[model samples]
Target chain A: MSGSSPGSIERLLGEREIVIACGPGGVGKTTTAAAAAAIAASRLGGDVLVLTVDPARRLADALGLKGLGNQVTPVPPEVFQAAGETPLGTLSAAMLDTKQSWDALIGEHAPDEATRDRILHNPLYQNITERFIQSHDYIAMERLYELHSSGSWDLIVVDTPPTRNALDFLDAPARLADFFSSRLLRWLIAPSRSTLLGIASKPFTQVADRILGTQFLADITEFFVSLQSMYDGFVERANAVSRLLADERTSFMVVSTSETVPLREAEFFATELATRGLDIGAVVLNKVLPTSLSDPDALAATRRLAQRTPEMTAALAARLDVDASVLDRVLETVTESFEDFAVVARREASSRERFPLGGATLLTVPQLDRDVHDMEGLLTLGSYLLGS
Target chain B: MIPLAERSLIFVTGKGGVGKTSVAAGLAQMLAFQGRSVLGCEVDAKGDLAAAFEAPPSGFTPVSAGENLSLMAMDTEASLREYLKLNLKIPIIGRIGPLARAFDFVATAAPGVKEILTVGKLCYEVRERHYDTVVVDASATGHIVGQLAAPQAINELVKVGLIRSQTDWMLDILSDPRQCGLVIVTTPEEMPVAETVELAAKVAEETTVELAAVVVNRVLPERFSPRAEAVFDRLSSHEGIDALSEVLGADSASVVGAAALATTMRRSRVQHMNTLRAGLPAGTPLVLVPYLFQRADGHRATRQLALHLAEEIDR
Candidate 1:
């Protein structure tokens, strides 16, 4: 094994009840989460569910499925055979349906059929459910908490939408709480309260009514009135998510690459997780360049190759019917090939310095020559992730 | 090549972590260098553009970045507030703090409201002639299509009211190919290339914006000679290790490994580049930006990328 044991990731998969994979977008967060969940299911002998927010066709392609819907799709035994791995336990995945989840949440939490119908049919609710800020994050957390408490799977792997920063997901519950508790909601629920305040505020309502227009204001007032009875249900759900995330069995796997911007985001995410006292299992750095060329002897070898530029040009000139001037350029290409490795080695060294992850076992996956387009690639990546 | 400099509003978006911010900044710099007053706006509210330029945070207001460049970090809340104050033209209680808070809460809950406000602000800036070129560093590809589509969606959804009137003007400029354009920035990798192809199709079908160009960032320059390939092929063989060791006067295994590693890097780059070229739409301009050996994070790196883009597009 390299420096970190292969069991580092495996430990998180087997021991923890919930594993959340998070990072900035395009760093292979979805692939990492899917692979780990699949390996844990097959190796650790437990039922695992991967809840992904991946785009429509991405998860299906990764899991080698025909198509994926919001419902759970189990990984078949044939897939394990195709991946060259033995199947043991069960593996299932579901892509989050943001709007559907919101609708279902309203149905589950509404005080009565009348209120539920009113809220569902409201133009504002219809619009908000589809495009609210971090609605995906908020609903995903709700779904994770719900599924976790249901005792359906031994381990649940949640993949978050790549937000502007990791803090958005961490801060989602509190932000939702704030939005729910704002004074505006109270006013919208009971506009009559404005008259109850004082005589000084009496004219304010008229001005607002005139500006927002009477119908729009009434629509806002009606929307809140219908949602007012369900406010406690929302607060309770949000609190449950917060408490679950802070629980001991819940673990977060921070994934990123050894690049400056991703490392910066990883640092921000890790630091925020630490501040929240959430357990960070490992910092999975993907697409890392090899550190071999940084050795002094390799550097000397590259320099030696560069020193033989004249002979290389002569040899290339003798081999091809080309002009003498083009031969030197071709020779530089040969010598500089070695120099390319040196450049990447130096860049990775500098990139490593910018990484903020500390104390947690750092797992590095070397850059693969090809993109993982199928289940075979996922299994290979999973082996690397599990340190096999 | 896409005539990006001529467009009033240029949207730069791609998959996350593909250096969209830097590409947007580099495009802004390139345009500014040509004497066009550029407003580099980041719509996701990450505000990394200010940091990339080594300037203080631009907040939600436009801050002068360089001689001809300006930067703004778009905040949906702030944009909503401005929309109410300016567009609604309400008299007295509209300017109150609680009203803005109320608007923010309701708008945040409403789906297209936030997007309309954000894109509405950008479109407003464009129509106002605020800058010669307004380059927006948009959010990830998944959300950006909806952001760009909001004006047209609202235009179709709400036929009357002040909202409809406001979105109508924005939609006119957005759907007009001359006024607005989109540039996709992606690495020469498999997933991003696949995503970019899908994105191009989606933007075409869902929105009025045009896909102006595709900037293939961080591409390795494959300049290997036949002799170099032959040498690498020999070093990869069993007996060639001893030959390479004799040639280098050092340990052959390490030298061979380095040579093979170099060859692998070049081969992968060629494969990715091929995937991108073959996959993207025909006749669409593909601008190849060389991979910077240094870290692509700082202002210097961004300016260097800008220079490369300037030369590539001109050619």
Candidate 2:
């Protein structure tokens, strides 16, 4: 892909209202998404906001900020300036706290003041809302919709949870919603009613039964009874969150390493996204080994040394013995491994060749020597994002 | 020499993203080659173990990666379902499929339940004697500690019956130095070596499993000697140096680069080895594996790793 051209990824970003970057852990999704947003904001002269749900708070660290909560914070203009780029546009970022988001969601969805007070105050409700239902992976779409609906920026970029199946993050809102809407909630609530009725009708009998046998089960049943009202409220909010995620404004950008497992995950996540009618803007294959060797003569000399050194030659022979192939075959295999990796790189380059969305574009970032840690790394990534 | 038949559970763990899965696969293959029935288990949900065995991603069922080596990728859902069936005595899981699925999902939603379920399943495999040797490609250091400590964690939560009994038994086995062995794998780099030392200390404090040995993989071989350096220097300034220089220019850089890398690597490796030697017991051995030029993928690379491991284990 030409550095100057609007690659498939760039176009996709330009056209989509929301871009979700998803991948496995430690694959540079956060940095990549941040860079992409920075690129769109600076190069395209569009307003961009990047939202990240990783609890590690690494995104803010990457962007050279103190901390980010639910509110959008403008990235320092000096960061882009340091990278030799004038800030021709604006970029903002926010780190989503799932617990805070859940609390906000409850406050927004509560039916009445008394209901809200009762629900929010209940320990059971707090557990379900703050702990059980507040996972970043499950609430990604909620954050996306929250950012999208604000109308605060022209484009929104979301850094998804780290998982092999990126679509799982996309599917979480709906899955949680389904759990609440399903009959399981009724079952959870039922025992409470039965216990209350039994208390009203024959308290002594039930109490004696509990004391005589099944004491553990009785305690568990009592705990479930206390949680009934909160469970109902949780179900209602989960439904609302699910509906917002299934909307068409959302697009997925799968980030992965060129390694087999990561690529396979990308393929799987892509298929899952397609099944859910979510548009896969592009597959951002990260950490691809450069196709052209920096120096070829060095490779030939190393090959010659392998042929000449007794110890090295012995190691090579031992390696060949396990595989049991002829010299020609061994050379062919070695060549093919390199060629296959190049093919993967080419495929990634071509896949992002054209942005499917009219105004959006695709882009590629070459592999770097070190992991992205501080602001300098993010700036390096940012430069790559701008196709520098 | 210790007979291969007596070895029961081989717990292989390393720093995250190292070739732990590959090492586990090679170990299983080597054991299988010696006619031992082996089961290779990967606790991570990435299902790379299935990929190694060339099996589809539905990973509950064990698939044969080789003649006597079988691979199983632990699925959180399947494990939860089985746990519910066994613990709650809910037989018709299909009839209440939604509830079953919900329970499975909710159970995993709890903080450390997933780790517990994974480790619980592995313990089941070990206790059942389904394989003569079970190799666990456990989670990274932090997660592995939580995983191995699950039995104790669950013991505190659930007080009676099979779960408690099983937890007790598992803890007993893990805490016994003779029954279970913990092999810490590391690269000859500073961070991984540091992490390995910390992990070993943590394991020592929390559990009774013996620190069998440390496997330092991916060490750069020493490539230059004093004589060779002098010869290369002379060649650089010799009368016919220009022609030879043109031919060997890139090689010179490569050699220099390799030498520099080796020097730094050797220094760090020796420092780590010394630290480990001082910290660990007197008898605990350290094994160093040279970095293979090839990537750790496919059966060929796995076999090569097995050969390297054979030397280490034999010692």
Candidate 3:
């Protein structure tokens, strides 16, 4: 969907069915996803769904989520109306419950009720779903695929997991596919015998048995053996998920703050997406200092006021009907604070100029003084996000 | 709450991108600069250790970072190999390849196999007195409790094994507050504060490790007193700006506006900080690290932050 066209985030949201919002953590990725989805539904007119990882408590309430679940809940129409936006379409939000999602996938792909019950009840099933780091990534991908294929929502914006490595979710599907087909996995599930394959896996089992104890090994073996029954279903679903990522109907919006660390990570992720021929719809930078702070004349005036604070305090105090001592302190702080922020603003401007966008549209949101919690706050952010 | 430098092992964790690595690096550097031999390990192995120190890349093997700081990344495979060499007395050179592959597979499949190795290595360093202190840039809050509780989880899962036998000492070290502690770093913001509070609760509930301190990083300076604040509020308006422009011969609105923004940001952050303090346990030492408007996330920032942390500690 992203090519040689006049592509803003508004167009990207309208055009693509899937928009993957991913970047370094703690940079408002989840909030941005929610905002983008809210804006799309309000402006572009569709049933937009935001699949967020973890939202702030108030934000969850704003979306009408009482507690955690995989159920997609619709944001009340009155919530949007309160924000002064009459949505043309419905907005829905779903928190990605990793454990429940894995259970649901097994429910869908299980060969029968007996196998499903066995796999679900197995102790290793709980451990693997909860402890396996990559399990969340794979399930997130699969859930997106399932939701898209079900034709439930017109647009889906996904807030990716906060992975230590940025590429984990992107590579999760192919990696899972390969893992399912791995020779080692096949060997693990095969019945023990004197066959050549069995003999090769014997030493591994013995070593593992010695280290982990035979009971744990047996538990692992039984779990995997049960999981082997659904191997064909998992691999086909994984492949489909991988294809969905690369499809033209999907787009990626890489998000980050203007801070050095998160921005650098985001640029690397953006570059990796392009290297893999993925469409980068837009590179959104959040919490950028306002450009007005960087005005040269403003910096000069602040310096002049700071230096002349003592001389002008009395007269200025009289004119403004304030105490001279308080005015003096206020003048000093005001000027010094302005100078301090100017340095940061100018530095941010330089980083903005230096960031490599390739061909993706660049969107920036200023550093709002207040935290975004309710729909009103989100709409305030969404206005900036839509570049209105 | 033991002082940061006094703890034999300190796991530094926070929400991602809140300067966790830099704070870890700063704590290690500060201790090392104080003439204590320190070992710093990056648990996630994201190469942030090297970035924070501006040093060469580190590996499982320790490399000299400065006067007394040795930096390395946490590699469970290497830790497993070392454990076998010490405990089992296995030569393990040629045999370790396939053995490590199998172990890696098991580690991937099992719940606490990999995490125990990470915690075990740090605990081993502490017990052996290889360094005065070991600083770990541990996983973020989401994964930290799981990582720190690895020994307990292992004890639950593995009833009998070499790994089971090793859990006793790791648990002892983790259970002793004087030996091991957790330092959580956060900026005064909504999500980070919420996560920090939750992590503190989880640590108390699940792990034996003590919450040593909460370091609030990137706190903006508040320059306006109540009276000065009232004075500035007037200056932020249209009529007051005209008066300021008459005095300075230039429109002071932008400067005044920028200052107002900074003040407003700090004011809102004060509310979040109050909520954070309330959610945390009473008497928990709250260290404030002032925001740096200059360079960021580099060696220079690390040094500046280290100095700021020292001043806070001294106070």
Highest DockQ against the true fold, candidate: 3
Candidate 3 iRMS, in Å?
Answer: 1.5
Error of 3 at B59 (Å): 0.8
- Candidate 3: the clashing residue pairs are none
Q: What is the lDDT of candidate 1?
A: 0.76
> Candidate 2, B205: how far from true, in Å?
8.6
Ordered by DockQ, highest first, the candidates read 3, 1, 2
Question: Model 1, B9: alpha-carbon shift in Å?
Answer: 1.2
Q: List where candidate 3 sits over 4 angstroms from the true fold.
A: A1-7, A191-201
**Of candidates 3 and 2, the better by lDDT:** 3
Candidate 1 per-residue C-alpha lDDT over A119-192 given as tens digits, one digit per residue, 9 for 90 to 100: 99987777667755478788889888888998989999988876755667777877787777876667555644
Against the true structure, candidate 2 has what lDDT?
A: 0.60
B1-315 per-residue lDDT for model 1 (tens digits): 337678999999988888888999899999989999999998876668887898887878898989899999888768866776685566625456655665575566445777888898999999999898899998788788889988776665554556667877898888777889999999877678878988998988999888889998887776556755665464456665554455567654654565566567667767777877887778788888987775567789889988999999988
What are the per-residue Cα lDDT tens digits for candidate 3 across A24-65? 999999999999999899888989999988898999999998
The i-RMS of every model, in angstroms, reads 4.3, 10.7, 1.5
- What is the TM-score ranking, best to worst? 3, 1, 2
Q: Write the per-residue lDDT of candidate 3 for residues B1-315, one digit (tens) a residue.
A: 677779889999999878889899988888887889999999999788888989887999999988899999999999988987888766687687778667856876788888999999999999999999999999988889889998998888888878888899999999998989899999999999999999899899999889999999999998788878888888788888998888888889898988888888898889989989999999888989998988787788888888998889878
